[model samples]
Structure formats: C-alpha cells, structure tokens
Target chain A: MSEKTDIGRELDGALQKPKRQLAMVFDLNKCLGCHTCSISCKRQWTRDEGMDNMWWAVVNTQPGKGTPKNWEDMGGGWDEKGEPRPSKIPTRDEFGDAWKFNKEEVFHGGKGKVTYLKPVNTKGESPDWGPNWDEDEGGGEYPNSHFFYLPRICNHCTHPACLEACPRGAIYKRDQDGIVLINDKQCKGFRFCMEACPYKRIYYNHVQDVTQKCIFCFPRVEKGVAPSCARQCPGRLRFVGYLDDEDGPIHKLVHQWKVALPLHEEYGTQPNVYYVPPMSPPAVDSLGKVDPSKPRIPTAYLESLFGPRVKEVLAVLEAEKEKKAKGEASELMDTLIVYKWPEDIFPDFVQDPAEL
Target chain B: MLVKRIDVNGDVLGDPAASVWSTANGETVPLMPTPAAMQPTKYISTKWQNEVYGQTKSVSVKALRNADEIAFRLEWQDPTKNEQRIENTDFPDAVAMQFPLSEDASLFMGGEGTPVNLWYWRADHPARARSDVAHGIGTSRVMDDVSISAQAVHANGRWSVVMRRALSVTKEAASAIQIVPGQTVRTTFAVWEGGNLERAGIKAFSPAWLELEIEA
Candidate 1:
C-alpha cells in the first residue's frame, strides 16, 4: 500500500502529538499596563532579597522610555556579520530602584517649583520610573490624545541568544516545550548571557550572584496551567498555550488566524510568545470622519515585525473585526476568553525524547 | 615593570599548541613557565587494546630574585665560634654607610610623617635561615629597587627560563615582575630560588627584600 500523505498521517496521530512550543499572546488594546501582571509576576518569582529589582515581566507605555529606559537603543542581538548577537548588561537604573522623591514640595507645590528645589530624583542615581512609566500620559490635547500599554516579558526564543552566551552552559531550553530556564545550581554568575540578551529582561541577583529571568512558568506550564502573569491579569488580555496545539488559543491566535505578531521578528530568535496587535485610531485632518481603509496599528509599526507581509496580516485582522462587528464571525475579537480551570491547574503533559 | 625579553625561539617538546611562552622584567625578575598541563588530546594518544590513553609529564620551575644586603645581626645562644661569616663590626659599618631613612611620625594622627626606615618584609628564608638572639635575623634594605632575577632547572639538566620582565625597572610599584612563558618558554625554576642553600622548616633565613611568584 502507498504511504499515507503527511497531512493524513498527522491527522491520524493528532492526539499523540505534543506541542513543541509554549507561547503567550497579549492583547495590547486591553492591557491596562497595570502592575497587577508585574506585581503578581514579581511576587511569584522575584520576592527573594537577591531577586529584588528583577522585573522579569514589566509594562511600558508606548512613546515612553522602556524598562531599561531606551532599551530599544542599546545594541547587541544580531551582529553586523549576520552572526547571532548577544545581550547587553543593564545598569542598576535599568532594573530601577526606590528613588528619593520630594513629596513635601509636590503637596505644597509653588514653593518647591520656584526655589528650583522642586521634587527631583536624587543624583549619583536616577529617579524611579516605576514599572509603568508613561501610562495614561498620552500626547495630543482634548479628547483626541492617545497612548497604549506594552507589557513585556522574556520572549522564550527558538534560537535563544541568552542560551548561546552562557559559557558555563547553565541556561537551557526544554526540547519538548521550548521553555527557557536557568540551572541555578550550575550557574557561576558570569552573566555573559545577560549581556547577550537583546531584551535586557534577565537580571543579576546580587545577593546570590546568579542570573535569573522569566521562566514562562515552567512548573505551572508543565502541569498545563498558564503562567501567573497571564492567569492573574485583571484585564484577561493574556493567553498561553502550546504552539502546535491546533485546538488551543495560542495556536489559533498566532498560526491559524495569525493576528498575533512576535515583537521585533527581525531578531530571528523565533520567539515563542505572540502579540494581539495593538490598534490606534487612524490619523485625520481637522474634521473627524474616520478612514475606513486605514488600520489602527500603523503599517510602519507592523513592517518592523511582519515585514512587507504586515499589510496582509493587518488586512486580515481588520476584515475579521468588521465581520465580527456585523455579527458574522465568532465574537472572539471583541471578548477576552479566559479559560477557567479547577484548583488542580496543569496540563497532563509528556515531554518529547528528541528534545532531550 | 616592563617585559625584558622573550625566548619564543623553537619547538614545544610535543604539540606546539600545548602551551604558550613569554617573559617580563622589573625590580625582581621571574622565570614564568606554562601551566604545562597536557591532556590526551594534547598528545597523540597511543592505543592500548581498543581504547586510547594519554601520557602525562610534570615539571617544576623555580625563580630567583636579588636578596637585600642585610646587616646580618644574628645573635644566638651558641658560644661565639670561628665559623662566623660576618663580624659584629660589619653591621655597624653597614648601618653607618646605609642611607638614613628620615621620616616624620605623626601620620597616625593624620599628620604627614617624614621618611623613615624603608618598608621591608620580615619573612624568614627557609633554606638560608638561622635564628638570631631575638629568635629572628635583623635585615635591612637600601632605599632603592634591589635588582633580582629567576632561573629554572629542567629534569635533564636542560633549563629554559624565558627572559621575562626586563630587569631595569625600579622596585617601588614595579618591583616583583611576573614571568610568563613566551614562544621559547622557560622550563622550571629550581635553580633560581636559593636551591640547595637551605632545608625546609628549619632554616631561619630572612630576606631583607621580598619577591613574589605568580602562576598563569
């Protein structure tokens, strides 16, 4: 008998197949940039003395300075040689600190402003631009002003740069699910991996002198439960699932419908996480008639990620949104579907041997 | 201290990449050698049965530095003997001839002190050692960088101490120059340090000058 086609074989063995990737999809439009995600994430992983300033998951407002301030500006992921690039070291300010601010003057107002002694960040240090720096501080006057929240975490990558930079071979990615993790016991604290990461998401634990970053909730994920950041989000904007699970939300959001886009795809790390593209109102002249064809998220912004194919992706999303608005497509676009699981959260998972 | 010269002249006994060589010079000269570590990969493994095993060789290197001319004020319990190499009169002459280390003492009170006795290591030499009346030898150094050097002796009477740091540098900050292997690496340093001059744990020799050794 002739061999079955690949698709036919895959169809027959669908239940036996395990997803090779774990990813998250963020709906930037619904993200409040509330530290709830950051706070929940911090409390879960970084509560230790050494892990103090590590905000493995943080939210930054667009058009505002990022966690490492101008993280987008610091260079190092891909080399000019087209070879893999490494991460750069983040300063104490990048991790942020409890800056001494003048509460006395702000309440009293006039006196501090005129005296040139108004509340200011202490020197030899920088001011605390809390996890959320520019939220609600959108530009433009009256009602037309706007800004969006961008919550970020370590993008567990397919070709993880941090993994390559570790000389001690302490950091590793699970072959089964692609979860990036640091082997704390083996880590020598050399921190080369931190410098190699373009995201600047990994942090140095001063007290322990080891390096740490987002683990994609390995323990929870292995049990088939979502991460703390995704589970506790009040906005219900985050979705977590395996990339190969066709029935799962992450698979449908990123591969099936394809609205979710990986941030900075040019880095070529093949980041597992995805984003439900943020939308902004199209630009207009003095009058306020909305342009039907123009997409909310700028095409220029999309180009940075999906490249020339961005127009195609945006077109598809817009079409889906329109169809949903007309009551034709599934109401998925308008509503955030948070999966409710029992107390025993986790997936009945079995890892793959090839990844081992 | 600056590098005096290097002896990167020829072939490494076995694999060329097995080790590196270099040299340096300063207040004290050192004969630095390679870690000289060789693994199975470092040499052509010979097959025993069906498995391959590596051969290893070990060597030791000793370095030499100039010892400060001490006053040799050795006082002992033994009765005065004719074998005494230094006369009691010699110490007075050496002290009188030595430069006066003038210094103001109130530095402890945050006041600037004048120059005084030079900084010196009171450590005893193992091989060339003997106790004085106070159970220690009285030694002194000139207020200048005392030139010192190191040399190595190989197992086969063959020696290879690279011309490490140039011996011309002054002692202050550049005193104990580090010796590293260059292209022509030095072999070992048993001959440089006062070898055969003293025995261990017994000799109470004190160096008026101190030299340091480092590993690469």
Candidate 2:
C-alpha cells in the first residue's frame, strides 16, 4: 500500500485528505444471492436493540424495490455543481421491520395441528417489504426474466454526504484509512446524515439515540484481517485492500482493468466500494430463437446503476472470457477466477480470523 | 422579567403546577425560525427550504428561585405529544434554555471563546434536562455531569415543564452557568415541534436574549 497518497478527498475543505483508503470490490457475477455477507455483518455488529431492522450489508435483487423501498427516487448527494440535493429520512416501514415469528404457538402451544408460523412486525402487521422481500423475483416477461444480486454496504464515500450533512461535526473520515465513522458521543441523532446519503445506508439507533452504520470492521482491519462480511462470504466475491496497492485485485480490477465501477456515480459521493457488473445470457425471442444482440439483463438498467461504462466493461469481460475459453493467457480472467484463495483477492489482508 | 425569590423549598419550585408559580409573572416570549443562512450545513439548509418548520409563535415562561435552587416553568402549545423516538422520522418535541458565559456570546449559540450553556429537555427524557455547553452553531456538547432536573406534564393541548438546578453548580463549573441572587442575566429560549420534523438549527428561537432580574 502506498503512503502519502491523498485518497478520499473531502466534500469541501471541511475534512483533511486521508493517507490511504481501504476499499472493497464485489464481483457481482459470482454473488449467489445466499446473503452470507448480510448474515455475517448482522452477527458481528447489528444484533443490538433498535438495530433489529438494520441490515448494513444487504444483498438486494436488482430491478426490485430496495431495502428502503424506492430509495432511488429519494434525492440525496451532490448535484452537478456539488450542491446538496434534498431527501427525506426513510421510515421504519419503508425499510421494513424486524418481523416477529409465532414459533412459540407452532411448537409448544399445543396448537401445532392448526397454528402455523408466520412473521409479523412489531406493530403486529404483516410486513410488506424486507431487505430481501423481492428475492429471486426478477423483472421481465417469461423467458427473459432476469435479475442479479447487489450486495450493498456503506459505500464509505470519499465525498460522503453523510459526513457533510452532520451539523454537529459528528461524522468524519479517518485521516489514516479514509473509513467514515460517526462519533456516537458527539451524535445528537439529528439524522441529517440519513437524509443526505444517496445510498440510504445509515440507520438510526432508537435505543441509544444515535446513528450507526457499517464501520468497515475497522477493529478487524487494524488487526490485519479483512472485514467479517468479506472474510465470511461463502462465494468469495468480495475483495478487500488499499486502493493504492497496485498489486492488489482492488486496484487492478477498479483502476487498471477498469472493470469495477461505482454504483450510481451520478450521486457524486465517489463511493469506495465498487462492483464488477454482472454478465448475462442472451435474451430469447417469442419464437424461442436466441437473440445474441440483446442480453437478458437489460444493459440500460445496468447503465442506470453503474453508469454508461457498463457496455465497455461488459465487452472487456466477454473478450477475456473468450480468451480463457481458447486456452489463452488472460490476467483479468485469472484475477476474477480467484485461483489462489485469499491471496488472489485480498493479498494484504490474508490473516486467518480464527488465529486472531 | 424578575425571578422572584420565594421561601419555599426546591420541591415546591420544581413542580410546574404549584400555586407558587401563579405568584410569579408570566412573560410571553415571541419566537421565530432560526435563520436558514445560519444553519450549519448545506444539506440542512437545503432541506429547510420547502419544509414548514419553527411554526410555533410564542411560549410562556415563569421563573423562581429558592435559597439554593433556581426553577423555570415553561408552557407551550403543542397539540401532539410526541414523546417517542421509535421511528426514523419521529423527532421528540424539545425545548432549551440558553445563557451566555460571556456578554459577548452571540444569540446564535455563541462564538469562539464565548460559550453558551444550554439546559435542554426532550419529551422522551422528561425527568432530566441535559446540560450542554456550546461555542457557535452545531457545537453543543452535553456536559459530563448533568446538573438540571426536569418535570413535565402534557395536558389540555399544552405542555407545562419545570427545569430546576442548583443556583451554582460547582461540578464542571466552567461550563455550568451560575445564577446568583440580585443579578440580571441574559437568557434565550428555543422550542422544537417534533411533528414538524424540526430539530437542531431548524427550530423556533428567541431572536434576542431576555434579561431576567433575580430578587435579592
């Protein structure tokens, strides 16, 4: 990792530039919709009271209403001139609730024959949405229906709208690693951060009366281990390392190969987390004839998310896949394949968490 | 407004409904929205543009002091009793009393080297008021030792709250405002209507400080 690099510059001069920036790149093509990252993040950080409904690392199905329901339409982040765009705070019902189950009635209430287990929210109403309420429910007509898993965490943006929105100066990016954090001691729970975050990643802790989000597992990162979400990912789709580490996959995939792109770059926060856009099979016509020109997963939708570079990135990926198919050497293909376990993905953070 | 000196104990002064409160003259303090230009961040300033916040027109206040304690009865009309911070959009109704540490402290929360001490109470935390010291906008810090005690009752489409504290708190004395007998102090007030989603610098506040003369 290179030192003295001015990474994650402030929204204005309100914050000092960081020496280094830790980032993650998710290979969206490899994600299995298994939610290992979400479960790992929950078990590690968000099991407390008032955090029952918060899923810091959520695997959202593309082309579906996200965790907060229509978060895309909610305005936030900076506009073209770096002016803050207005947005409302997402409510509990919008993000869905921590549903309670009738496990007791089904198993031990002696009504097992008739009583069935069902989930109900704190208000005792059936939840209309959840973090994965639209799981596997892809969009499009019969044969062409398609979707991909989009696992999201706090983007840890360089120009963090959340950090800029905090009136109390409670949210800041670390000068060392560029990890954005909320100073719970200083936070008055104004929640302007939630309003300003285009990604809608921050959560309000009602019990503690403060705002909380993904910390990037700083404690584990400082101990030379990757974040729990990355380390525990069963699909090994998450790559973690310093952005300036040219040998690292994060730098190669994002800066060198230029395949990984930030989601919703128009939000203008410069998110640290990037995604290698997913590839899909060709669409089928009404007569069941394969249409090579049209991808099942619409390119327009991906462009709306990762911006117009989706076409270029997809072309490069397809070319590399063809090279590998013909038994030719392809550096990009090898990096994406993860042939060497942790070393291939996160070379700098290969420490086994079990040993720690 | 004079804070009348009474022979009653702290308990009598701490109750908002006490008959002794009737003896003290009530002052109707007019309030206005905190200037959007003075808001701390661009996001807050932008969000406040279309929102109807700080709509509360005025508040009624009565001040009294016993031998060792000072108390104030504040009454404001708010039809909704928003006490819970359970939902993301739920902001509890709150009120604050501000006093300057130095005469130079600006009414806009104070400036550098001129801090203001704030006695803040929220509907959710009704039993105690947080003692905060701030230096300019968005700088309010909750003191290590909370010195103010609060009692509040919501009824008849209005809220009656009593905030009580020692005349002089020796602990964290630097941040705590000292209320001495026979002296006048400059103080201001702010109120937040949770239903309006008003918080931080988006609330109604007294444009100028009110001078309170304490009876010797």
Candidate 3:
C-alpha cells in the first residue's frame, strides 16, 4: 500500500484498528461563514475557566493565517517515511489570547460615554490576532478578489499523531467508532499532542493543565444524534456517518462519488474528516469582460491545501452541477442538494437532539 | 554522602537557608543530558535533535536528618526563573531525587517489576513536593496520599530548595522508599530547566547513583 494512504501501518503495533470509523464531510461551497458551529461547540464543551482561547470548531477564511497565526508553517504530523514530525507548541498570543473587554468601565461604571469598550489581552496589551483575524481578506486584485470559509474540527485521524506523541498513553482512538480523545485523568499536561498535531486543532486548558480538542460529540453520536457542529450549522453542509456504511452519505461522497478529499493528506495522519472543494466564479478582466480562463481563487492555492486531486474533484463537481442545471438526473447533485433534512445528510445519526 | 544527625528543629530543617545544612558535607553532583535515544517518543527526540537542552552541568547536595525526619538541600544555578504553568508553552523548572526499590534496578528509572520512588519538586508549587513511583521512564504516577514537605528560594540566578519527609513512611510503603538511619542506600538526581522547555526525558540527570549513608 502507498504510504500516503495507509494508516497506522508504520506505528509498530502501537495503534489499534477500530471496528468502525465515524467520519464527517464538509461542503465548503455551501458554508456561509455564519459561525453557528463554532458557537454550538463552545456552548457544549469549551466554556470553562481556561478555555477562553479555544475554538474547537473554527471557520477560517481561506488565504488567511488561520487560528494559530500561520499554523501551516509550523511542522507536525509524520514525514514521507512515516517518521514522526516535530512541531512547536503554539503560544497564547499565536493562537490569539481571549480578549478581555472593559465591560465594567463602559457599562456598570457609569462612564459609558467616555470609556468605549476595547479588547485587552492577557499581558494588558491590544490583541493583534484572533481566530478569524483576517476574515473576508482574500488574495488577488479588485474585480477578482475572492475567499471561502473553511470550517475545521478535529480530524480524528486513522493514525493520530497526538496519540503517538503522548508518552503517558493519555490519548486514544475509541475502538468502537475511532473517535480520538484525550484521557484527561492520565494526562500529565505535557502538551506533546499540541506539538504533534499537524492540524493544530488541540488546545491547552491552563486551568485543568490538560490538552483538549473536538470529541466529535461522541455522546450524541452514540445516541443516534449528529455532532453539535453539524447539527447547528445553518448551511446543512456537514455530513456525519460511519465511513464503512456503504449506503451512508459519508461513504458515497468519500468513496463512491470521490468528491470529498482530506485536507492536507500529506500530513500522513489519514484524517477521517473530509471536505468537498469549493468552486469559485471565473475571474473578470481589467476591461470588465468575463474571463473564463481561471477562477478568482487560484487553483494552485487550493491545490496546496486540498492536494493535487482538487482539480479532478472540482471538475466532477462542475459536470454534476451542469447536469443538474440542465434538468437531468444526477445522483451526485441530488446527494449534495440534500432534499430531506437530517435524513439525507446523516442517515445513521438522524435522530433530533431536541427529542433526546 | 552522609545524612548527618542534627539537633535542629523540624521547621529549620526544611529551610534552604537554615544553618543546620552547613553542618552536613555538601557534594557537587555532576549532571549530563539525558540520552536522546531514550526519549519516549519520536516527536520529542526529533524536536530536540537541533536544540540545546538539559544544559545544567551540576547541582549541590546536602543531607540532614533529625529524630523523626530527613531533609536534603539542593542548590542549582539557572539564569531564568520559570514558575508559571498558566500558558501552554510554559513548563516550570523542576528537580527530582530518585531511589531504587531494588539494588539491581537501573539508574535511569527502574525496570519492570523494579519500582523507583521519586521526590519531585516543581517551581510552580513552592510549598510542597510530590511523591511518585515508577516502574520505568514515562510511567511515573503520583502518590496523592503521601505529601513531601519542600521549601525553595530563587535568588541571584540560583535556586536553593529543601525537600524533607519522615524517616519512615508506612502509608504507600511499597511505593515510598523508607530511609532508615544507619543504612546505606543509592540515589540519583534529575533536573528540568523550564527555560529550555525541558521536561520528561528531556532533562539533565546524574549518570550514576550516589551512595548515601544516614547517621544512626
């Protein structure tokens, strides 16, 4: 098997194969950058004393530095030979410290007119970056400036770098559904997971002195309910199901339709979470004429993130979209459209959370 | 090194500046970097491959014992004081004394079935030390019920710390080393420089065990 596709094969018996892997597919085209997923995840798990800076579910604008501020430049995950890649532990400032606002002086102190609210960081300085520091700031010149929202969560990879990085065996992939988690009781606050995760999704909880990330809403998943992020997303772009379930949308999109691709597959972690590449309109010329040569969003930049297969996936998406526009039958377009709520996107986890 | 029998009060024995420590013979234990080959994970070894860490060359040790307890004063030089654990990247400076449960146990940590007791002191928690037991590297488990008293002061680019405990402990006896007077035992030392981001197997340690004799 190619080293790029294999998972846990090079771990030397350290990782165990899960019976079934739970996966999610995010359609970047439909994302509206509303941030409901981020808020839902925060309200569900990370609203604690030390989790002020953690965004377990983040929606970053493309061509931007991302949450940790140029995290792509930081090294992590595995090398081409399947050797572990070393990474730096991102600092509070790099991840953008939770801003402290002067609510007291503005609202309750009876000085609202004079003292307007301002955000101060931990060191009592103005914050330079945040989770969405460069929102809507896409690359390229005027008539063609374009960007898309890339909503991210823990990949819950097949061979998790965080699990292998931990010396105390504190991180594990669940045997039942392959949901990666940190066993806080066994964690010694070493933060090695933060250093090994290529995605840089893990956050350190200073109060608890432990590393934390997206748990994939395992409790809700176990009870036949989709993850909070997917359930709360207004775009209905997130698909959650068992990867091996042939009839499921996740399998169809990932294995059959092959439209969904793993982000940064070269990281060598074999992330279960996949994404359908976003399509952009063609760029316009300086003469105000429609230019069909290239898209406003550079294909090279998209290829850098989604890998070489992005062009092929985008071609398939374009063809299927054209067929749908011509009023012809297209399973791919029908699946992407999601005619029925909850049932079409997540058949296995279609149970409403409110009913539970 | 002899743990001298002193007539000092328990309060004074735990103080790093206490004059009672002057009576005991102090030894400068030489330290070396923990071998990179022994790092528990590949990521850690790779992270340290091009970096300089575990640079602390030596530490001063002095032991003193009273009627009921024993105390050891450790003094080491460090340019920076890192005592905060509030940030993800902040690792507090720490020191640990290791004692083997079996004579044949390894100095690096004990082997399987051969446990080692560790008296661990971190700069963040200044008032107390932790009692931990481990069968091998990366297996250290805290003995929460057992408390080891510690007092530390960082001044003039050097840290003076005193760690003390009962001469004999009954609770968690299997994990805790009972330092009996008039008996010879072996001990080793490891120091973590938080400024260098050293922790776990990435610290400086005495290569060999130092023999200790407590005066009866």
Candidate 4:
C-alpha cells in the first residue's frame, strides 16, 4: 500500500498545528528487554482494578504474537485509499486477563497440603495467555534463531485513527504538544477508539466504562519532566524532544542521521515513535561454518516491520559505527552513546520528577 | 393504536402486567436489525458488524395514560439477563422509545431541522431512565433531566419493561415531544440484547412509525 494519501493530508490540514510536535526515538540495538520501562509506567499510571491488565509500555519479542496476541493480523487504521479498515475488539483473554493466585488457600487454609496454589482469572478460570507469554520465543532454527525487544506505546499519531473514529468528539489532539487525549466526561465508553487503533494500544476500563491509553505523561511533560517510561529506562535508548528542535538528539537521530524509521508506516497513521533497526551477527551453518553475508536476523523481516528504509538506515548506522571506531568525531555515534544523562537525551523535558 | 385514559385520582396504571393493559389490543410490531451499512462507518468496520443480534422478530407494546401520566409496557422474549456492566466486555440490555418533535419528522431518528425526543432505559440502571435529544444519527446527547421512571423485570425468558412519564413536564426541553389529550403522534421503538453484545445502532428497530391517538 502507498504510504501517503490526500485524505490523510487533508485531515492533518484541518487540525490546529501544535506549537511543537513531541517525538521519541528508540535504538533497538541498545534495548535490553528488561521491561523497566513497562514496570515504571505501571507504577505511575494503571494501578486500578480494571486497569491492572493494561501495560501502556509493553516490550514484545519480535517475530512473535504481540501483547494482544496476533494483533498484527487484526486490521485497523487507514487503508491505502485512506478508508478505515474493518477490525475487531481484542477480548480480555486476548489481552491476557490479570491472574489472581490462591494466596489465601495456600497460606492460611488448613488444607494447604492437598491443594496447591494456582493462578485463576477474574472469571474463575485458569488463564492461557499473558502480556509476555511468548517472551524470548523468537523465530527460525537453533543456530539462525533471533529476536529483538520491540517496546510499544501510543504513537500519538499526526493523523490518529482513534481521534477520527470517535463520534462524540471526546478524543482531541492538544494544540500545544500534539498529545492525544480522551475527555472522560464526554466519553461514552463505546470503544470505537480501541477498534480503530492499529497499534491496539488503547485499553478499556470496565470500572469507569471508558477507554484509556498512554497519555504521554502530559502532567509531567507540562512540568518539563519526561514520561516515566523514557526517564526510567536503564538502557538510555529512548530519546524524547520536539521534532522541530534541530539540536536535540531526536532530530539528529530521526532526520539528520536518518537511522530511525517509524514502525509499520503502511498503517497510515503517521506514527511519531521511530525505531533504530537492530543489527545482528552472521548466521552459522550446520557444518560449523559462519556465513558472513547472511545476518542471523533477516533484513527482509526487519523491512516488513519498519518498512523498506531498513536497509539504508542499517547502512548509515554501520558507516557511522566504523567512523567512531576509527577515533573519528562521528556526531551520530556520540549522540547514540548519550554521554550525559537526561540533559543529552531529553533536552526540552530535563526536569527531574522528584524535584517537580 | 389507542391510549386508554384513566382517572388521575382513581387508580395508577404503571404495572406492565396489569389487567388494564390486557383490555387494549397489544400491537405486535415486527422488528428488523438496523442495517450494518446504515451504521456509522467506524462501527460497521468493527466487530459489531459480526454481532448476531436482533433475532427477536417482534415485540408486544401496549400504552395507557391517566390525567397526570402516560406509560408504555413493552414485552419481548430474551433468553438471558445481562444486567451487569462490571466486566470489560459486558454490555447491558437496553431499550429506547422515540417520538418526533414535528409531524413530518423523519422516521429514522428525524432530520437536522427536525429533532426527536428519546427515552432510553437500560437494565443496569433500573431506577431511572435518561431523556435524550437526537438531531440525527450520531447526534444523540443525554439531557440533564431525570424525567422518566423505568422499571424492568425478566422472567421465563421474557423481559417486561414499563417506562412512564408525566403528561406535562414542568421544565421545558428543546426536544421534548408534548403529550396532550386528543393529540396524535408518531413513535418508534428499539431494543438491544446485551448477550449478543448489541449497543448503539446495532439493534432491532420497528421498521415503521406507529401512530398513537390519545383518547380525550
């Protein structure tokens, strides 16, 4: 499918331009798949009863079914003709219902010896799936098998399908930082946003009867503090800043170096989250011979996830790495290294959360 | 359809199973599923299109009015009772009655210039009902008034709902359809089966407007 459309362009035109568009760039090569970002996000937001299952920032093993289980196969977002593709609402089971262990029976009950502790869901049934059920289960044979951590959150698209799909006009894109939010009072809990979102990031709060998603930590952003997921990341792989800020690492990595590419650009939402494709070591043959030309993680598979620009981005990264190894001043490599902490990564939002 | 008039001080006729309703011949209105093509494009593209509901082909409706109030008793077969919205995927069983503000208002929720008054009742909220105004599809807004009293009971695979309101409201609402003695009005009905996960436009609706004449 074509990447751009006149309808999408017109939709962008109708919206009031934000003073600055906030963006994020994630270097996949640096990701450790530790899920510190996910845990930090959970502690900050999603601690309620219905929100227990919500993982606003999820790190999934590539080439495997994502958080919602086979979410890539579920259609949403705009098609080639800029029309909404038919989709289905991901069930609680599909999203992996929060499991409840029999703590009382195991610890306090007198018949502890006969009955063992087991995890049961809210519906009183054993859960079959979970957020990281397929964690580290990559694709291909033993010697050629490979995987990379794909951390996902709300893209906060320039042309968000969730915003357009809301009939109540409850979803709005802020004119200041271009953050998309749903107005709780106006939201009728229809869940159209959940279906229209190609990323399947939006979640339903059964207690409140409304749909919820990653808010981009607007409360922190307003106070010049970065989101918990970005701030708490130990890898220092996530860079946050306004796209127009030429001096910021986001612009350097995304536009200047051209190493970061948006995931599934074919989804046609103009996603703001970009990824620096992962490079892998050469694959080994059954005869114990290493094939230098054949990378363990196929480039074609990466291209399918990040679009056709994967090859060029990888080539640029390789060239820059070579320059840096030769003791040359490579600006791209220096930025990726993140010499300073918050100051070098999120220049605009550098205020410490504790200080705020 | 004729709305039988009762003396205001004599006896209340709010019960759905009351013998007074039996005296009037109940109309068996055939209900058809609201076409998927007619639903909002977003809804048509979602899992709702695959929803299998509105299987009930018909419903029995009877109406009665006293000097102070008017009431409608709708009875339909529903094998399940889905009254809770506590679960993420749970949808409540619901029903709505529609009346036009003008004589020539469109039967399909009225047009832009012509609005419709809607009394919506859900099984989850059994005590009271919502008063809403709709200009057209996707333009429904709940008004800030608790003007209608609703009570529903499910038994033996059947649902009996009674929705009642005063003949004249003290407060004025833009979409309120005036109900007076010796007046003829057009009305429509919609039912949602929560077990089938039906909500919004995915429902069974009366194909044509039913003309009701209030007895003087």
How high is the DockQ of candidate 4? 0.41
Q: What is the lDDT of residue B179 in candidate 1?
A: 33
iRMSD per model? 23.8, 0.7, 1.2, 2.7
> What are the chain A TM-scores for all the models, listed individually?
0.78, 0.96, 0.97, 0.96
The most accurate candidate by lDDT is 2
Compared with the true structure, all predictions reach lDDT values of 0.47, 0.91, 0.90, 0.84
TM-score of every model? Answer: 0.54, 0.97, 0.97, 0.90
Docking class of 2: high
User: Clashing pairs in model 4?
Assistant: none
**Using DockQ as the measure, which candidate wins?**
2
> Candidate 4, residues A250-355: lDDT per residue as tens digits?
8888778889989898998888899999988889998879998888899999999999998888888888899999999899989999999989999988999887
The better candidate by lDDT, 2 or 3, is 2
Residue-level lDDT tens digits of model 4 in B90-200: 788888889998767777777798889898889988756788888877678788564788778899998888888887765765667778889877789998998887877
The TM-score of candidate 2 is: 0.97
- Candidate 3: tens digits of C-alpha lDDT, residues B49-129: 778888999999999899989998999999899999876789999999999988788887897999999999999998899
Q: State chain A's TM-score for model 1.
A: 0.78
lDDT tens digits, residues A1-356, model 2?
A: 12222254443455456778899999999999998898999999999888999899998998899878889999999999889999989988888788999999999999899979899986788888776788888798978999999999999888899998999999989878889999999999999999999999999999899999999999989888889999998889999998889899998998899999999999988899999999999999888999999999999999999999999999999999999999999999999999998888888888998997
* Residue range A180-225, candidate 1, lDDT tens digits: 8998876645455666677777787755657889998787666655
Give, for candidate 3 chain A, the lowest lDDT window spanning 10 residues: A1-10
lDDT for model 1 comes to: 0.47
